[model samples]
Target: MLILGAHYRLAFTHSILAFSQVINAATHYQLDYPDLALILALVRGGSLARASQLLKVDVSTVFRAVRRLEAALGQQLFEKSRAGYLPTTLAQSLAEQAERAEQALEAARIGVEQGGEVISGIVRLTCTDSVLQGLLLPALAQFMPNYPALTLELSTSNDFANLSRRDADIALRLTRTPPEHLVGRRLADISYRVCASERYLQSVNTTDLASLTWIAPDDFLPDHPTVSWRRQTLPGVTPGYRCNSMLSVTELVRAGLGVAALPDFLIGDGLRPLGEPLHGYDTVLWLLTRPDCRALRSVVTLFDELGRALKLP
Candidate 1:
């Protein structure tokens, strides 16, 4: 009984020492604490070479920093294999925490820069080609001069900007249904009309619109309002030219390739409206922002300005 108790006491003391070492390593890991950026770069870049490129550092520097971090933490943070350096579970958790910390830092920095009085900093705005070129640019010509400290980054894409990912501060989307996660006001219903160049109209019979060769959006964009409306309204009509880009379709129509459904804003470029505006093709233009984005002073100011400009008669 005495021997067993002595062995148990020794084992218990050894376990305590091991636990203390772990705690010391965690608390005293000074090099690891500030190297959260390095950790995130490594995980996101997937390899030392990639990480070095992303961080604009020498590969040796990245390797040394990671080595120091691992030594300070007293554990392996990644597994090296033929594929690449895959982050361990601990490293994954650290990267997530680092991301959160980075976001917080950015928010604080933005706040300090704005100083509550000045409406400044970059406001990323996304929209389709027609909205960006036709409507928003003209409004911005007046809006930007008034806010000299503000910077606007415009991204034109057909795909909806993912506000949840912070892809853009604001998005001008043409849709009947906007995503529920975003908050915004519908600006106005964008009108769509069938248009053809004067040169094309001379060749094709205007009386029988269904018999004319059409310039259509590609099958990939079956959900586009113009594409869907065409399919439903004009049965048995096929396109002579198919394109995925609305801007390209407009250019094709202007070149007299075929008649296409186009927005009213684009009609002045040597393309004449065919008939009355096509039914079921008009979609509301929405100015959208994430809940967090709506709180930013610069974003709020720009959002309101864009809303007013778009709603004007």
Candidate 2:
């Protein structure tokens, strides 16, 4: 009985000692070099010899960096084989943290050098193709002159831009209700009218919905007022031609393919609005962003400029 108790006590004490050592080792390993040192050396420099030359350090210095990184991580972060020092599972898991750290560090460096200077960080805006054509480009042309140092990168995608995820700094959307976790401001209650080319008016009568050929956008947005009107009024109606972009739809309709319902902003000077008014086709344009980005100067400026550009006389 005494021997068994002693053995049990010894095992428990050793387990506690092992756990304490793990915590101590983890706390002691401090990384002094810049973030992504190991990964950058491995990817860009290719081998230790080339990496050391590029990093302006000795080969053993690079080796020690790898060792220190592994020690800091308290894991076998890499393995030496005939091929090279291959990263272990833990290194791969920490990849995103390293990248994020590098970005934060870059932001810090920029802040230090450009302190009290004008705004200069790149502004990434997410906009729909339609908004890009109708609102963003013209607004940007006018707004950019005011802020010379700020750079703009417009990302035009139909997918909902998750502002919290940094998908875009700002977005222009048409919605009656703003989504949760987003800050939305109503810009305009945008109206549209049915219009067609003069050639099409001469060839076909578009006074009524039936027996009138129409050109429509290829992808149907469920919330689109015109699309909803068409589905509600003319269920079996199929257009002669369908294209994705508003530009394509306008061009196809202008070619006298068929009459199309278009926003006045998208219409050229030549096209005439039809007399017949479609119901359930008025929508409100909105500017939206995550709360954090909404406070950003770039996004707020975009909202202000874009809202001004969208108004029609």
- By lDDT, the best candidate is 1
Write model 1 residue lDDT over 20-58, tens digit each, in one string. Answer: 343334456543335778888999999999999988999
Clashes of each: 0, 0
How high is the CA lDDT of each candidate model? Answer: 0.78, 0.65
The TM-score between candidate 1 and the true structure equals: 0.62
Candidate 2 lDDT tens digits, 276-299: 556567777777777887667656
After superposition, which runs of candidate 2 have C-alpha atoms over 4 Å from their true positions?
A: 1-116, 311-313
- The prediction achieving the highest TM-score against the true structure is 1
What C-alpha RMSD separates each model from the true structure? Answer: 12.7, 13.0
